[model samples]
Target chain A: MNQRSQAVRDLLEAVRAKGFDPGPDGPPPDRCWHEAQVEVGDPAQYPSVQESQES
Target chain B: MQVGELIARMEYEYGYRFQQGDVLLIGVNDQGMGGPQAVLPIEQATVEQQVQGIHEEVLPMVHRDYRNLIMVRYEEFDYHETNGFHDQFTASLDDHPGGFEVVAQYKVDQNRQLYQGYMDQQWASPGLRWTMPGKLPDVSAQMRELGYKEPASSEAEYLRSFQPHPEPGFQPLDQEQEVSHLNRLAPRVSVEVARHALATTASTESIEQQAKARQTLGHLVAYDEDARDAVAYDASISPAKKDALVETYRQAPAKQRPALAAAAGAAWMMSGGGLKAGRAIMAHAYQSTRPSDRALVTAAEVATTRAHMRPEEIQEAFGKEIGTDLEAAEAAHQEWERLYSSTTTQTETETVVETETVEEPDQMQLALEHQMNQPPAPVASSGPEVD
Candidate 1:
């Protein structure tokens, strides 16, 4: 294994030793694909900004 | 693949490097449960970046997918990479996983050294869950051991250390003994120490014991100027106690009332009584005492003369008996206002001048106005005559 993978393994060991079980799961969540499409809404549409300007 | 395996694969494939003090939180949900969803790796550049990323990214994702079980792993590579290193311990509801429950874990990294040293000293045994939910470990002893010192008697922990620890099979002190014990200690220590001791006794002792302790405290507050001032300013003391103390001052002899007047006024202010009421209390106390007592007069004046007091309020508080001190305070306040207004006007004038000077002139308009005003330039252009 590479140095990075070895480091990850060591960290996982410490985490388990500290009683944190990631539980039975495999692969990253499907939401990983949605990360690329994070929406950027218009600033004027924000309620707080509009309220502040009105005030 | 396992979660760790996938993280390694993601790091390798995407060339994502994890540095010291990096945190990674992964959310997972059951496939068909219509529950929480997950997100990809978020790489925050700094502490501020991470905070913003969590607020903007992690929080919304969690809100959208409320059913996800989040597994958070924070890694610090080498202790020496930074001057300080801290561990993060987070816990959430076994069912839902990311909400207000995660606040405690966020605080862990700020005091890493003290916490790590504390955990090492106290709970070094294997498989112990030291940072379990609803359990906050006491680290004041470890903080002291690590040479983290606060002001001498200001800290609650320091005050608590003065309390006598009950031994095994030892009986608690009786009311008389407790009062006697406090009386003996009250004369030797400063007013703050005495106050703290009395407070400690009042919390654990019987009602009669509390009354005796309060009576002794009243004596200290009446006789000792520092004690009265300390009690007045102490925010930790309850408003009810301050009210009682102010009553004690009110009942003091006319000769001693002036000295206690300022303290009483300050206490009144702290108890949410308006400044008007506080000034009235001071004025009443002053009226009871002889006006010849200059020290008492000064104390009353100092109490009454505050920056927030308007001229009208001062006039109403002191009435016809307004001393030179009040007049001087009023004059000083007026002087401050005058200076502030003058400074503001000067700044506004300078800004206007700078704005006018900074703009490029309309050369054509200026030339036309110059031609109209100069009476044909004295016909010098046509003649080109000698001087």
Candidate 2:
């Protein structure tokens, strides 16, 4: 997915909605690639951190 | 976009000349070798900074033999598309053998988190995007509110939903159904036999039995002797029906298919017939493929290629693997091993294959005729095969 794509921006905004701090030095505490499972709210992914939030 | 435009944009953004031989920033994953990583196209993954909290879990599983296009071509970044994944998903990317590093930071802007990395010209291709399901089945109220959706019923349906899991731990559609027959029956054969046979099957096969199994069973591995054996026996048919089987499987509905045993007496004939035929077919399948595809890479190319790096980076990468990667790989390996064994123990008993049941002499004769009709095995004409 395009890092700068508007879709990413909208998704990032949603992720921001959940209250996150993307350290000035890093992308976001909960954000990494899909494989990382940090789950910055990409509905496109499954078996996510949200599962953790559920359990 | 074309390479020229891409390079120009990168140069403008990163503030680097990025001469003809500048480093190309390929795909990165934080799981490579130890602490947080950034797998680069160069030796030791060209990261000036080591990020925090990489998935140390993945460090070991990524050692690979294939030369990722990012490693070979600087201009080839376009080929590796970011599907639905985050750019810095793992914080460190290169977990493969040649963990990349910047030959010379084409442009290192401490302020802007930009490292101009470029690889050689060989990594070009059509853009690839990972096709993965948005999310796995969970008791999500959101999805529940949306309504219940039926399980997929066709290959096209699954493909549309098929999201390629980056973790090789999860069995892909083809392998999920594999009885790990090779693992079981293969052990019944010699290790040499199993390796030889697997190496023998050209990087393709009917795999219908297993593929169909995956489609129906949501993928499985029968680790124990019985289930593994049944899988192996079913897979034995792979050599005989490899091509036709694959064709049938591709079109096969994406659901459980009752084992279609011996569609006709001729099935055995095509499946290479009884014990002897099975052995022959297995041996051939185990052996390296005939006229294997050659890479045609030369030492000169290795030496002269821009892909080469100084001694320091190579040593660093090796150190990472020896120190952190081995442990990580072992962890992932053990986890998968546990998963396999867990599935194995939960196995319901299987019906014995009717290997000798009512062997029709006509079927045997047809098989013999079929063998005679086909050209000689590769062993007869050529030597060992390699890929």
Q: A1-55 in candidate 1: lDDT tens per residue?
A: 2211221233234334434453321212323211311111111111221121112
Error of 2 at B312 (Å): 32
Candidate 2 lDDT, B289-335, residue by residue in tens: 21110000111011111122211222222112111122232233233
Poorest 10 consecutive residues of model 2 chain B by lDDT? B291-300
lDDT of 1 by residue, B1-387 (tens): 222222322222112233334443333333311211122223424434444444444444445433332232234222333222112222213233344222111112322211111123454552212232121234345434533332232112322322222331111233575345434433224354334323423342344434444444544544554454444443112444444445444444444455445455544433333223344445544453333222222322332221222222322232222111222322332332332233334543553354345332322333453455421111011100000
Q: Backbone collision count in every prediction? A: 2, 45
CA error at residue B243 for candidate 1, angstroms:
2.7
Candidate 1 stretches greater than 4 Å from native: A1-55, B1-188, B197-206, B235-238, B250-262, B270-272, B287-305, B309-387
Candidate 1: the clashing residue pairs are B36-B67, B36-B68
True lDDT of residue B97, candidate 2: 41
Report the error of model 2 at residue B3, Å: 11
